[model samples]
Every structure is written in structure tokens, then in C-alpha cells.
Target: MANLKELRGRINSVKSTRKITQAMKMVAAAKLRRAQSQAEAARPYAERMARMLASLGQAVAGNPDAPKLLVGTGSDQVHLLVVVTADRGLAGPFNTNVGRHARNHIRKLEAAGKTVKILTVGRKGATYLKREFASRMAGEITFQGKKRVGFEDANAIAERLTGMLEAGEFDVCTLIYNRFRSVIAQIPSDQQLIPAELPEAAAETASGEAQAWYEYEPDEATILAQLLPKNLAIQIYRAILESAAGEHGARMNAMDNATRNAGDMINKLTLTYNRTRQANITRELIEIISGAEAL
Candidate 1:
């Protein structure tokens, strides 16, 4: 229902949009490759670390001298939710899904009469929570211009969190982020960071695997004190890598869909433009024939 000129303009606009979306999709694909590789590579190491910590944690389970990071401050009354999101979006719900999950968790904690504190990583997550959780924000970390998320980035976050934990800012901490599953599937997950949740299997394995005479050289407690902090950094690093890969995968899918939709719109507009032009030409020809007949 638009004039030819208007239709032409609309079609051109869609074509331009299509071009942009196509470019974005290609860029996202390129980025996804590297990000995905990095994420996949980190998994084995992280899992191994988790297993090691699980074993060490079991050894110190009943010991009062165990690292506080492993034993916690003995209260779950106050919870800190560390929400991780991408710094940039265009990745559809890659960021929003995680944010929504975190929000739901916060609400659930509040409903249970537990105090909630928020420590957001990435600008998008912070912005998402700020609308409702501004008062509960303990701090925020943004890696706006970082080309790639590295262990250093995770270490920085770990250091701040460690400081906060030492300060008694919160009793328990949970990290929420998207876990990279596939190009089309980024699953949001929650991990308990502080007082590291030990698997029941860990206790069983530890007892069976240990020999009565097997003794830790530096002592199990001493090794745990050192490893617990490194494990936190490793876990955080893995989360960031998974989030990075997932963001690219989500963006690639979103842009591909956008490009296809734009192409469809352009085709529809072109069809309308042709029909309208034909109608106008036919009317002009009819007028000429009628004038000649009148003559």
C-alpha cells in the first residue's frame, strides 16, 4: 500500500540491512571458531581441578583448620550472586537468559528471607540487574574493550571476590553464566563458588582411594589453602570462556536469522513494487486507448 518511491526506499533499506546482517553473521562465525576452541580446551583442566579439589576438600572436611574458602563462614543467611554476561549484545538472549536466571534466583532467595547481594561481571548483566537490584549491588566489573577474556581477567575478578569474602560481605557465593553446549545451544548454569560444594561421590572416592599411610607432604590442609584460591580462578576463567563462545554462537544464529528475514522482506517489497508499477502502466495504456477511440 505504498507509493513506488516509498516501496523502493523500503526495499533499499532492507537490502542494506540484509548486507549488514550477513556481514555480522560472517564475523560471528569467525569469532565463534576461536572462542569455541578456547572454551573446549579449558574444560578438561577445569574438570580435573574440580576433581582434585573435591578430593582435597574431603580430606579436610572435619578439620577446623581447613581453608575458609572451602569451609565457608558457617552461614548461608547472606548470599552473593555473581552474574556473568557478555559486555556486548546482538546475541539475542545469550545475555538476557543468564540475567533472567540470576534475577529469578535473587527473588527466590529474598522470598526465603535470605539476604541477597549482587556482584555483576560484564556490563550487560549489571545493566539488566540495575533496574531492580541497584540497592543490593556490592560491586561491578566490566571488560568493555578486552578483545578476549583471559585468565588474568578471571584472576582479577577472583581477587575482588576473595577480598569481599574476607570482608564478610556475603556468606555464600554463586556464579551464574551460560555454558557453551553447541552452536545453537547455550545452557545457563549456576555454580557454588564459596565453601565449594563437594560432591557426595568425592567423599566416597577419597575414602577408597586413600591408603592409611599415605600422607600429604605439606599436609592436606596446607595444599588446600593454596589450591582453593587457584581453583576459584580456574572456575571463573572457564565460565568466561564458555560465555564468550556462547555469545558468538548466539550472535551468529541471530544475525543469520536477521539476514534471512531481511531477504524475505526485500522480496516481498519487490513483488509489491512490480505489481504497483504494472497497475499504473496498465491504467495509462487504457487511458490512451480510450482517448484514441473517442477521437
Candidate 2:
């Protein structure tokens, strides 16, 4: 039962909101295309690198002299969770989904009497997790105001993780992020980084194949020593690309929904404004008729 003036104000406010949402939707859509392409392009190489590592490391997996990145620190006492999220918001539950997944993972680890540590990649995730897990934070990295996420960013993260591993900070390291699935679906995923989770299929294929003894120009151990670090960076880069693409997809989907909702609200408000204005005009006409009749 708002007055015409109030209804007009409400309608104007909704119209302004609608314009902003529409603009955001368009911007997100434009960004999603580039992000999606980059993410898709990075996947095959990343997968191949992982498979190669799995096949190559099959021989030395049980060796005590193997690289720690491939063999881990011989314990599962401390766990490092690399939680990745978008630096910005307005992306529906995109950030929330990963945050919740990480939180649940931490709780499960704690329940099993395991020590948990966190390395957050985005401001949103750091802010979200610090509410309940302030002390467990090992580090936080944010890339706000950046035009795009690049391989260098991922390499920097990998370097930090490597440094932490060398410092004996954590036994096992896992990366959690949103994987780009489609425009409307970004799946929360977790991948073990340290101790490089090798694919059994690749290992079995390599071991079961009856081929000539192919010797490495530089031995398998030498190749693994060189490839392991690069593989680490590549894996992290893939995660970042997937996360970037997923963030854009989520934001685009969210903004599209918001724009549609704003349009609906504007329509409803316009109808209400028209009804209120008509009621006011009829009331004024009735008042005039009443006065004329009295006269």
C-alpha cells in the first residue's frame, strides 16, 4: 500500500539496480570466454605431464633416495591444504562451495587426530576461513586488481609450497579448488600435490608393456629430478587456470540470474507504481466530485 511517490522511488531504484546487474552480466560473459579457453588449453598438457610422471616414477617410487616431492616425507602427521578461490565476490556460492569443502576436509582431518595447516590463495577464501581457522593459516596469497592470472602466478605458488616442504612444514599437501565443468557447473575438487599422486593405470601400463629396454639419455632418476619441479608448477598452473575459468563461469551465471531477478522486480514495481498512481488519481477525482456535489 505504498503511495505513488514511494512506488516511483522504489521503481527507480530497481531500474538502477537492473542496469548495474546487466552490465556486470555482460562483463562476466566476456571474461568467461577467455578464461574458459585458457583453462581448456592447459588441461591436455597438464594431464600428460602427470601421466608421464606416473609412468617414470613407477621404478623409483619405493626408493629411499627418490625426490621428496615424489615420495613425500614418510609420514601423514601434518596436512597442508592449499585452498583456492576467487579474490572477488558476487559469484553466488562459488567461493562458498570451496570454502565449505575445505572446512569439512579440515574437520575430518582433525577428527582423525591429524594436524592441519592451510595456505589460502584468494582474499575471499582467507576471509571466509579465518573466521573459524585463524591460527591454522600457514600463508595467504591474494592477486586482487590483476587483469588476468598467469603461469608466473602459479609458479610463484609452487615455489612457496616447495619452500614450505623443504622447511618440513607439512607432511602431505592437497590442493582444493573449483574445477571448470561448464557455464553453470563448477565442481569442487581436491588433488594431492606433495607425494605426487600417480595414476595406477599409467604405472601398470608402463610396467606391463613388453617393449625393448628403453634407456634414458639421462637416467630415469635424472629425468625425474628435473621434471618433478616443473610438473609441480604445471599442476598448480592448471588448477589456477581451472579456478579462473570456473570463477568467471560462476560470476557470469550469478550475474545473469541477478539481472533476470532485477528485471522481474522492476516489472513488479512498475505494476505497483501504476496501480498506486491510478488510485491516487481516482481518489483526487472522487474528492473533486464530492466537493462539487456539496457545492
Candidate 3:
């Protein structure tokens, strides 16, 4: 029932919106490619490092002088959750998924009467957590101003975590992030970092499966002491990479959907416009003929 002028304005507005959505979709697609590649490239190294750390952990399992990072602080009364998410959101449920997963974990911990603390790594996660866990939030970090994510960012986060641990801020620390599985699929994952959960391989290495005993130049304790902190930083870096890739993938898919929907809407609107215009023209012609007949 809209007049031609009103309908024309609506059509123009939609067209403008369509253009913006299309541009965003293209940008997301381009970014997704590079992000995906980086995520994929980092996976093997992170996995291998985890395996090696696990093997070493196994080797040192029986040693009384094992590194504190490996053995932990002997209590789970206090818990720290490091939740990572994208700094920006246009990405459907990407940030929401990560936030939800962290919230679930927090709820479970709280139910068990454990003290919960939060360290948010991105603005989205911080915003989400602030709604419910504001009191528990220990700190927030954002990469908004950075041109590119780097190891230094991860190191800074790790340093903060390590400093807190050394200061006896918390007992157990867990990291939550989205793991990029494929373009259409991302899995929310939770990993324990503090008290460093040695992978199965680490346990195997400790069992001495090899025929020859391995000797350490600086001693196992000393090596592990250094490796443990570095491993924590590496793990954080890997998680951030995974999250970044997943965010882009989600955004690309979301924008693609938006663009398609906008196109469909435009089509529907054009159809309506044509119908309205035709009706108006037919009405005008009939009025003219009636006037001629009256004359």
C-alpha cells in the first residue's frame, strides 16, 4: 500500500545496504583465507610441542624434584579461566560460543564450591563475561590496536598469568578458545595450562621406553623449569591463532548469508515496486479514458 515515492526510498535504502553487505562478505572471504592458512600452519608445531612436553613429563613423573609447573600447587581450591575470543564481532555465534563455553565451565566450578577467576583476552569475551562474572574478572587484554598478532602478545599474557601464579593468585588455570576445524566448523575447546597437564607422550617418556638413558646437560629440573613457561606462552599463542582463524571463517559465512538474504529482499521489493507502479499506471489510464468518455 506504500506510494511509489515511499517504495522508491525503501528500494534505494536496501540497495545501499546490499552494497555494504556485499563488500563485507568479500572482505571476510579474503581475510578467511590468510587466517585459515596461518591456523593450519601453526597446528602441527603446537601439536608436536604438546607431544614432546608430554613425553618429557612422563620421563620426570617419578622424580621428586620435578618442576613445580609439572607437579602443580597441590590444591584446586582456586581456579583461573583464560577465555579468548575475537576483538570484533560480526561473526554470528563465534564469540558467543566461546563465551558460552567459558560460562558453562564457570558454573560447574562454582557448583563444586571452587573459587573462580577470569582473565579475558579479547573485548568480546570481556564484554560477555562482564555481564555475569564481573566480580571474578582478574584482568582483560585486547589486541585492537595491533596491526598483527605476534608472539609478544602471547608472551605478555603468559607473563601476567605466570606472575599471578607466582604471587599465589590462583591454583588451577584453564584456557578456553575456539579451535578452527574447518571453514564451516569451529569447536570450542578448554585446555588446562597451569600445573601443566603433560600429554600422554610425556608420561611415556618418563617410563623410559628407550633402551638408552638420556642425560641432560643442565639437569632435567632446570630444563623443565624453562620449558614449562615457554610452553605456556606457545600454547596461548596457538589458541589465539586458532581463535582468529575461526572468527574470520564465521564472519565470512555470516556475511555471505547476509548478502544472500539482502539480495532476496531486494528482489522481493523490486517485485512489489513493479506491481505498485503498474497498478498506478493502470489506474491513471482508466481515469483518463473515463474523462474522455465524459467529455
- What's the TM-score of each model vs. the native? 0.95, 0.95, 0.93
| Off by more than 4 A, model 2 | 202-213
Using TM-score as the yardstick, the better of models 1 and 3 is: 1
The residue ranges of model 1 lying beyond 4 angstroms of the native Cα positions read 202-214
How does model 2 score by TM-score?
0.95
Where does the lowest 10-residue lDDT sum fall in candidate 3? 202-211
- Model 3 lDDT tens row, 1-295: 9898988888899888889878888887888888878777877878877766765677887777776567777789999999999999889899999999999999999999999999999999999999999999999999998867988889889888888988889999999999889888999999999888777653554767653456776887777788888899999999999899888889988888888888888899899999999999999999999999999
The models' CA-based lDDT, in order, is 0.89, 0.89, 0.87
After aligning candidate 3 to the native by TM-score, how far in Å is the CA of 244 from where it should be? 0.4
Model 1: per-residue Cα lDDT over 1-295, one tens digit each: 6889999999999999999999999999999999989988888988788767665666678988667798899989999999989998889989899998998999999999999999898999999999999999988998898787889989989888889899998899999999888999999999999988886654545667652333687887677777888888998999888898999999999999999999999898899999999999999999999999999
Candidate 2: deviation at residue 189, Å? 1.3
- Which tens-of-lDDT digit does each residue in 1-295 have in candidate 2? 9787887888889888878988988988898899989888888888788767766777789889899999999999999999999999999999999999999999999999999999999999999999999999998999898988888988899889888999999999999999888889999999999989887754545767642344786788789878988898998888888888899889988988988998899899888888878888999999999999999
Error of 2 at 91 (Å): 0.5
Poorest lDDT segment (10 consecutive residues) of candidate 2 = 204-213
Span of ten consecutive residues with least summed lDDT in model 1: 205-214
TM-score, candidate number 3: 0.93
